[model samples]
Target: MNYRKATEKDLTAIVKMMADDVLGKKKEKFQSPLPIEYVKAFQNINEDKNQELIVLENEKLEVIGTLQISYIQYISYLGGMRAQIENVFIRADQRGLGIGKKVFKWAINRAKEKNAHLVQLTSNKERPRSIKFYENLGFKATHEGMKLHF
Candidate 1:
């Protein structure tokens, strides 16, 4: 398998992966359907210089996974830059084989390359496995994260 930055042609496959990740026949609270416009917004990541979308592909260049990072410079952290990992998804059958870790490491390295002081992510409470995966990768849950449906 190969991991590389995503391009326009990879959108359809990436969206499918994301949809599966979000609504995979699981009755999780986080399993809400995503609007088509939300998927279209991912195109902005490809166009933005400070943000990026990556796709994981096989030898045949078929997209099977995706990861994205958004950079934020903050004053509260002594003017440090932060990179937030978002929308990370792997093809369902491809889980548990270290591909997620591989992509995560790649994202970390990329953030470090960009001089980011922190790399952050949030896993839904329903995804205990994913939470453990992030913990194994050195992420800690230090603060309560809340969302309001409006």
Candidate 2:
């Protein structure tokens, strides 16, 4: 599998993969031309120095997985840099192939290369299996993650 920065051409496939799951099905609007909002969001992320949108492809060059990493600089932890991983999705057909672990390892190493003090991610509480998978990856539930959706 090849992992690299995503391009505009890969957006459709990326959105499709993200929408395959239950949670994503409710949140993503995956369509043939894709909504302009997604394009705008991609452009914003691409322009940000701290944002990285990545895609994993097979030998055939098919985009099969994707994730976004955001490097946040804050005054906390003595002004440390934190790498936040989000929107991780492996194609449904590609699940159970250890690809998720490999992608995460790559992301973590990338964070280390960027000198991030730590890497973090939050999975929906409804997805117990995903939480367990994260636990296997050495992530701890040290703090409760809360969010207020508008």
Each candidate's clash count: 0, 0
Per-candidate Cα lDDT values, in order, are 0.81, 0.95
- Best model per TM-score: 2
- Per-candidate TM-scores read 0.85, 0.97
**Candidate 2 stretches greater than 4 Å from native:** none
Residue 86 CA displacement from its true place in model 1, Å: 1.0
Tens-digit lDDT string for candidate 2 (1-150): 998999999999989998898999999999888999999999999999999999999999989899999999999999999999999999999999999999999999999999999999999999999999999999999999889999
Give the per-residue lDDT of model 1 (tens digit) for 54-142. Answer: 89897877787898899988897789999999889898888878889998998999999999998999888988988999999999998
Off by over 4 Å in 1: 22-39
Whole-structure CA lDDT of model 1:
0.81
